[model samples]
Target chain A: MKPESAVVSITVNGTPHRLEADTRRTLVDLLREDLGLTGTKIGCGQGTCGACTVHVDGVRVLACLLLAVTVEGGQVLTIEGLGTPDGGLHELQQAFIDRDALQCGFCTPGQIMSGLGCIGEGRANTAEEIRESMSGNLCRCAAYPGIVAAIADVAEGQGA
Target chain B: MRPFEYARPSDLAQALAAAGPDTVFIAGGTTVVDLMRLDVLAPRRLVGLGDVAELRRTELDGDPVRLGAGVTMAEAAALPLVRERYPALAAAIDLAASAQIRNVATLGGNLLQKTRCPYFRDASSPCGRRRPGDACSALTGHLEQRAVLGASPHCVAPYPGDMAVALVALEASVEAATAAKVVTVQVADLFREPGDAPHKETVLGDGDIITAVLLPAPRGTSAFVKLRDRASFAFAAASAAVSLELDHDRVVAARIALGGVATRPWRSSEAESAVSGERLTPERAFAAGEAAFEAVARTHENRRGIALGARAVTAALLACRGG
Candidate 1:
């Protein structure tokens, strides 16, 4: 059977786009391949690796596990949308830079995205809490201590 | 993944009307999309249940707590009522997957999630659970995580879920909708042993949609302990959930369930009976754990898992004492 297509009007980072999406294509594919949002990297096609984490309707979720059509009419926020309006880096991104949280930088976008979710969910209160909450996003470079410190620095209201 | 049509139903009736043998109801899409990507499962239609408002409702004040099928694991875990009254369920959800997954994974989907058995997941491998005529690959490959209880000659892949184990111990029931009417099935009876028909996992009929999970009034304090290869983002090697009530140090009531050590969400009646009447001491809890796995048909590969399961049971039961 030919893969069915559905017209999906999704708002990404406050910008709306209407496209006919394949039912089989994941949200990550739609975001990167279709919308040109290359910041949302696909690490593990499965849900295990949180490299494709994004916010749908203000809730963080794994984009790889969701069909592009399933998120129609929903508001999505990816790594591209997380920056400040004046092209300034988001506080979490600045915190990662300040704390030297990233090594290979492959998982940084996801870590920052999930870190924002962690902070939004009030899970970045402490070091342990941040680690537990950020466990979803894997850093193969093993830059965990800095990652936790970065989240903690932001959660502690130290971000500048 | 194979090409399939998608439909988003706004209500239960519409969702039910769209159901068929070739159709699948997608809630979280965590398990469904993963398996579909592997070409392990291909359905003609995918019915999106995300817009069904009725399925997202949660009734906590009632005698039997009604948690809607669409309630995400993170949403369920964040509820103060659930965290305070049913800590075991909260812990089970908290310890599962990760925050990103919990935000999307619904309670109903969590219970119906597939096993983590590599052989069963790899479509290239011959798995009886995935294809009936195909031989069980886990039998000859890696049995380290296979079932130590409720296993059959055909398959021994353990059920890799923590929520169902906690639900079974708490005496929860699943409300499902069929073409005829809504029916309730005990959480313990929802899963089936991998017997001759290793392909069939649940008792629900084709096109049956789970509506909600009903939990009876809070029985007592409960706890969930999971033994895994790592702390987070990994399936349990062996885990236990225990609920206990004490009358001045003497045990009044007790319930126990095991996960990652069986083919189904295992409710250990023997463990409950062992700790029921007696004061729950450390030694007594250990004995209860021993009784929990006494009937298990242990083998060289799964013996360690059985031992870990026993210890997990003891740990969970002991944790419930101070709660």
Candidate 2:
């Protein structure tokens, strides 16, 4: 028996790659283990936790539940591929670092991804709205008020 | 996880043939993959259905909006049409898990997903529904959120999808398929009254796959009011999706469905008809809400469902009047 495996070609962090994987292998595993993109954390293997968040064709998806085959011809962006690193950081990333929004920093990537989604979709208009939109990304340290303030700062700044 | 053969078919016909006796089709895989990891589903051949282009469109054909089963809850809610015409459906999608899960979770998987019953999750607990012939743990353990309607004596597990509640209230239908046949069943008629077959949730059998959910176009007024423990992402404790038709300020037609409180997606057309033709004043709307749960059999934990469901009905009914 030629051990049953799925062959999928996907674009990760703007690079195209193909691999053979078991049906059970999550997109997160393929990203971290195979592609060497470990910026996407694995908080809860189940869908409840947002640690494994990544942008799939501009939409944030839980990497653990995402099958690599689903994104065969689609674009994927992990935290490593987020911004021009030598050119400083993305606005949300700068907000987190500037405001001390991150405590242990485990949830910062997921938080930034979700915040980007929020800002991109025009849902994070106010502090309350930012909090609601960012509810999916959990910080065990409960560093939420600062997170909200940082995201809200950007939203308000954009308006003024 | 048991190593299994995997094939991604691009279209429906290829998907149909691949869904043979030993093969099970996977879409989204939020639920099935979980079960597979837990050793609940043990098929030797797994068919992946993500590339079926037809299963991802949300289009209005004739009367209803048909959502391809592959469409994610997040994607469906983002559709401008659903946001304008069916806020309940959009709200239900929003209230399901969280933005991350919603993006990856498909409409078909959400509907076809299995129980949250702790015993069933255990796999060894052997609820009659989980195994061929075993005792129902829901009857003994926490049975508050168990089904009050259409529950078989052997199984009273609640149908745990919020979208199903809104769709049932909106009079939606679902398309199901297996290698042998393809068919449509009203969302209302999908879940059978629990009888001897405790494991079976809907008319779809072992080999069948849900293809799409057809949502009848909005006729009157509708809203979904869900009450949960958290203001954030959580399942409904008891919720109501109400669609009411008003004539000259009086309700002429009503469709009511309950969520997080029943075995199947609970729709009470009788309760809706009770307030039909009555002025949808606060009093009448309240009365209609109360009437919706007339025969609701409550257990130790979910006595709150009846009252909460009534309040939800009033809220949804008020939404119909749209200020």
Candidate 3:
């Protein structure tokens, strides 16, 4: 169904974009559909799953739960912005790869996006804290051990 | 997400006026937006309170701090005043949803969040709250883990979120603005009992907008505890928010409220009086918790309600004592 209202201007990964989207359209759908930035996925859709996670105004938010109109004039960052095309992943992404933190690859993008904010915000000070913070995003494969390792690896390397 | 007309009002007055026949006031849109997508709210008008600046402020009003309804859980949790003076409220927000959801979920939205009854979320299910004529599937099927307190003839649903208990414990109040006038109501009396009207949650009329949540200064050491199947992700099976004002080693004042086990946020002066004059002790805390829940009528399958609620209340009291 077409959304009856809302015209929003969003800066996705530093690129200015405009769309006359509906209130029903979520930030994740806007990114993936209108802008074709499908890097952000949708899982639980109820904000329980981190699959649709993104950073809005320098903070992490579940895009699945955020209305497109609510984010007008805000800066949004997704996993697609964290690294270069030269295979040089962000430090968190590199740590995830080094630690084999993913299995099915379905939750990797969300995990990476959340991890970026976790490390960037300096909240991943301890493994326990990372585990506690990451509880919202579920890994059906239960790949927690590897995920923790990836986060801890970054914190440890940072001398945290 | 079902298609709907969206309006982003720049101010509170505009937003309140915009709320009408099928309009919902959305702040953060962390919970209400999802429900709209589920078609749970087929409101033709989606009024965005996001741009309403006055509704996003946090300031002191007399002895209490007035937090605008639009303040997100994450922002509220990170506030210095919230962390210092309202640890229980802060913890409740910190423990809710996730960092991601908290970043977008507002305090007013948290209180206004619908029940987490799986039946209610499933539109096809026979839930009285969703469909007037539908039978309460939860009343007969999978009655375990349903409401243990304040169950009504129309529904046996449990309020899922954790912030309500904390707010109730702190004696928080709300400023509700309607198309006609704005009124202040206590958090303790905000919810309307689901006697015959299962759909009515708050007393606010069709065009009312929740302007702000005014939280009184916590009287004592405050703590909020939730007992859930999972440490996170899951809603509370039982929860309690306890505030204790100690006269050195003796209890001077106490406020207690419970969640998950009640249809609405349950506050018990009866429970607080049980330990009002006693010295801080585990036995006293236990006594207060039991007294507060003495009126609780737990069913067979969810007998754990009393136990979990008691444990949460006692734990909060103990936290007050720093024990």
Candidate number of the best TM-score: 1
Fnat of candidates, each listed: 0.92, 0.62, 0.92
Question: Sorted on TM-score, highest at the top, how do the candidates line up?
Answer: 1, 3, 2
Q: What is the lDDT of residue B11 in candidate 3?
A: 88
The best candidate in terms of lDDT: 1
> Against the true structure, what is each candidate's TM-score?
0.97, 0.93, 0.95
Clashes per candidate (backbone, < 3 Å): 0, 2, 0
TM-score of chain B of each: 0.97, 0.92, 0.94
Instruction: Tell me the lDDT of model 3 at B199.
Output: 81
Model 1 segments beyond 4 Å from truth? Answer: A1-3, A158-160
**Model 2 chain A, poorest ten-residue lDDT window?**
A1-10
Share of native interface contacts present in candidate 3: 0.92
Candidate 3 residue A34 Cα shift, in angstroms, is 2.1
Better of 2 and 3 by lDDT: 3
Docking class of 1: high
Model 1 Cα lDDT, one tens digit per residue, B63-103: 79999999999999999999999999999999999999999
B136-175, model 3: which lDDT tens digit per residue?
7887777567777778878889878799889899888998
Candidate 2 lDDT over residue span B129-186, tens digit each? 7786787888877765666566666887877778988989889899887777778999
Question: Per-residue CA lDDT of candidate 1, range A1-160, in tens?
Answer: 3358888899999999999888998999999999999999899999887899999999889999999888889999999897778899998899899999998999888888899899989888778888899889999999999999988888889432
